[model samples]
Target: MEKKNALTAFAALSQPTRLDVFRLLVQVGEAGMSAGEIAAALDVRQNTLSANLSVLLHAGLVRNLREGRSIRYFADTEGLRGLLGYLLRDCCGGRPEICDPLIEDIACHARPTPLDKIGQYPTPEDHT
Candidate 1:
């Protein structure tokens, strides 16, 4: 991704509500949630959720599809992947080992497992 696009993605994620919404959408995958569902899940008011969704949509970090009379929101994986690639393109001085754990963390988060009190997540070492 270009610098401007990366900045936009980062800005969109900087907010707490937007971040939560994005993470939730990512977890749900292509089976996205409607605005009402997201609002209920996040315990947020409709107005607040609408504003957050609008910002995310403008940043290209989120996309929506019409489901009858409702719209379902989803994470824009292409945009997110581009942003992630841009961030890690020059990370850790070209050492893949240094980035392995980080990738594992992301993979862990992508699944729908409950986190423990210690916030321990499955790592590459866990399966070894």
Candidate 2:
């Protein structure tokens, strides 16, 4: 990601509601959630959530799909990867080991399941 794009994403996440929305979307993975569902989950008003969602969309941190009358929102994984890559581009100078643990902690270890092919970590229920 370019510097400006990263800055926008950071700024969007700096807000409490937007941050909560993004984290919640990430947790839900590809299944995504409708606006109503998101509003209910976050206890945010529909109008307020709409504004926050728009900010996240503009920052490339979140995406939405039109599902008939409602819109379903999801974390934009590609955008997220770009932002993460930009941050780690010069990670730990020349000491690769310094960033190893952090990388390991964030990286997924499980194979992708049919229901979640985007490298989201499998939930325990997935094994059932």
RMSD, every candidate, angstroms: 10.4, 7.4
lDDT of 2 at 17: 96
Best model per TM-score: 2
Error of 2 at 24 (Å): 0.7
Position 47, candidate 2: lDDT? 96
Q: Estimate each model's TM-score.
A: 0.77, 0.83
In model 1, the number of clashes is 0
lDDT tens digits, residue span 1-128, model 1: 49988998899999999999999998887778898999999999999998999888878788887667677888888888898889889999988899999888767444355654544221211110
- Which pairs of residues collide in model 1? none
- Residues 19-124, candidate 2, lDDT per residue (tens digit)? 9999999988888888899999999999999999989998988887777778888888888999999888988988989999998988877755746545553221
Clashing pairs in 2: none
Q: What is the lDDT of residue 87 in candidate 1?
A: 85
Evaluated against the true structure, the overall lDDT of model 2 is 0.85
